[model samples]
Target: MLAGFEKSTGKPPEELSLPWKGMPDLKTGEETVEIFRSWRPHSMLFNLPNGNSMALSHEDECPLHPRSIVVVDDVYCIFLGMLLENTCDLRSHYGLSRQVTEAMVVVEAYKVLRDRTPYPPDQVVRDLQGKFAFVLFDARANTLFIARDRDGCIPLQWRMARDGSLVCSDDPNVIAEACGNCCTFFPPGCIYMSGDHPLNKIRAITWEDDEGNISSVLFQVDLFTRLRSIPRTDSSANWAGVTTVDGE
Candidate 1:
């Protein structure tokens, strides 16, 4: 399973780190055996493009809540790390008049996707108060979306495969094993989407401005359309000062 990554990254098997809150397990003389087993039962693996794959896991004792994944129809969503419910806008939106659990939020997100809510996914994400990250994949549409909480309390990382597929997970070591030095942290307060071009192409749901600061104003308009208007620049500098909406 990791052979492709090992051949591509050239870091060999010993240097690799297990994805999430786990470590690589190697026997004597650097003989690779297995990856560190996560204490959290919610950990899972997913198939990515170009034969690549991704995984999500968390520390059972360290994290406030266990991570989880929910699949609704063609959409698969994974929620990792903790959430601050009091800061979440559950009462105002999604018609959730009562307290919510992590599973409830997952269901609501699935509903939003099924209903094709008029609002951008980022808006829904903005209303979610948490120190976490999520990856949503629409199998039928071949679209992959990722989002991180504003404070970035939880970590998410990604690396491009030799086949140009994007492999993302919450573990930097997982990325390191796959990408070597090519791995990087996913930006906070931003929604990343790879539409149609799910293999290697990804664009931030953001607009460019002279001040090098991203303002929340763009959230009021059609986000995808806005992304279309802006020129496709590969530089991350354009993402500087990008702002995300805060819930009331």
Candidate 2:
């Protein structure tokens, strides 16, 4: 993956760029027939957040037939993109004043695409990712998410695409250009958000697993917790707190 993130971070993958919107299909003069039988060198990308991409292979091994290793670099990706292009050019050419600089560490590391409201109402502004990543999209929560690298070396691949898209890739020519058929691999850090496409809603989450499920949590205690902390105007409150109408 970008020459093992440029040999474990020496830095140099076209100075880097995946800010979010998609771009990285570095194909030049024909590549890939690799089912075996010599011919290697590859990488293709796109993940401006919604463009959705990934396909990088670099492995050609054979140390006296070490169990006939067929293309030994099965994308165990640990991308650092060259220590993030030398810490984003040393925080923009040594200006680093700090507000968590490096442009707010690349915008608070994609701040849940702007404070999380969940899925495509322009998914936090149509996604757009950065930092040692993996991204797959069906767009506007059309399902199939596969983001990556919580620690896992970037190996990725996911399924669904007989005529239904919801893919993820690390080289089957990006599943033949977004699901013409190639789905399956993204086992990295793990971010697979799938209801299982084709207009997915398949319920069965059956009440359980709540550890960040704030139950729409609200906590206030000063200035009435900054003005009655929560209440988006269904407008009804009595007991001397005021505001109660309905024929009052």
Candidate 3:
């Protein structure tokens, strides 16, 4: 994964800080937020179930493209970048007041995809037109939905820590420092959903412009506890053929 990441990002793995061979004392959550404070002033950390954690932060440097977090009905979302289309439409569709933030729109969208739509998660993601990346955690359901824009307009990366915690961030340096060569870029145009619900799945999707080709790949943790990607094709008869895992 690191080799592929370096090849695509043009950043050598050796340049990253020494990898943490074992777990550091990050369970308290404060230590993890501090790592991000070096880059942004505003930071918040959420301690997730199963010893997992999420840290979000952003600066006031770009007012036009602001970062936002919204919690509604036990669903928490952190969004970066703008939803150029369907922001208002989604707000109206969900009967959300105009005062609601963009993060709320994302939460409603996820709910629709998870509960209402028969379309695959990747299909809903592919229809979205914007430069954005978001992480939504449904605390009540113990599920997580993460996605990046099709063009890779916003940065996002993830890696499994030595302690088996999943770490994700927009800053590659932070991810590199924590997981070193183990880190990899969260593939563009991919949606990763993991939950106890039978309908949830982890899918990494790709599309080619020249031929309008589309493909889907499933991500699974093998018996050896290694993340592996298996290529798959779309089947109308079994749209939800992929498997899902609980929050690791």
Candidate 4:
């Protein structure tokens, strides 16, 4: 389970490692609370095969508790966040509510997966304006998606599991407890997808609108050996891969 602060260490809680040997098994309700009794009470636990479990807890500063973790259909997620702007435009595009809150953004995200013939596009999330980190799991597809905001204001961390699954959370200690010095912070401004179907690479393209609004869009495209024909920028070597493209 993702936790806030470690009750004993006084530091942030560790991202709980699932299926690690010797760790106590966590049940859905009472047993889960017993482990985190001294910490926050808002804990959600899901038991997996071979005694593995996933848990998530909201921190003290978060206001999206109780309703933070949601499970609809075969998709489950633990989200902690607040979108900086109203989602009227995004929701309307998806035919959702103009009054939808950021807490419900996961629902829209799920809708994209269900309605789209293929996987959702990266622009689906790149256009989102918010400060948040979430872990989403799709049971039917046996896939996992983890993402954090661009600024990294919200905390998230992860460590690899024995089966190559990512054990991630908002708490570092939870990972440390399971991985024993293997835990590290999850990178900001990125989304991680894992499953039978996965994205190969993430790319960025920049262009200008008729109104002269320079827009940068991040999305996924087919893998290529090398990108040799893109336009270059005036920036020095420090700028590296960032180049500009003219929009028609």
Highest TM-score model number: 3
Query: Which candidate gets the maximum lDDT versus the true structure?
Result: 3
True-structure lDDT of candidate 1: 0.44
Tens digits of per-residue lDDT for model 2 on 150-218? 333434443332222233334444335533322234333323333311111111111212653211111
Q: Please give the clash total of every predicted structure, in order.
A: 3, 14, 0, 9
lDDT of 4 by residue, 122-205 (tens): 433565677777766666655455667667777676543443333556655444444544445555666655422223334434
Candidate 3's C-alpha runs over 4 A off are 1-34, 37-42, 60-64, 117-119, 123-127, 195-248
Model 3 steric clash pairs: none
In the range 100-207, model 3's lDDT, one tens digit per residue, is 777787787777766843445553354356788777777666666777766667766664433334556676665555444444555555566653222333333333
The clash number for model 4 is 9
Go through the candidates in order and give each one's C-alpha lDDT.
0.44, 0.27, 0.52, 0.48
**Off by more than 4 A, model 1:** 1-43, 46-54, 58-61, 87-107, 196-248
lDDT of 3 at 131: 80
Arranged by TM-score with the best first, the candidates are: 3, 4, 1, 2
In model 2, which range of ten residues has the least summed lDDT?
239-248
> What pairs collide in candidate 4?
1-55, 13-173, 13-174, 14-172, 14-173, 14-174, 14-175, 15-174, 15-175
Question: Per-candidate RMSD vs. true structure?
Answer: 11.9, 20.9, 10.8, 13.8
TM-score for all models, in order of appearance:
0.55, 0.21, 0.62, 0.58
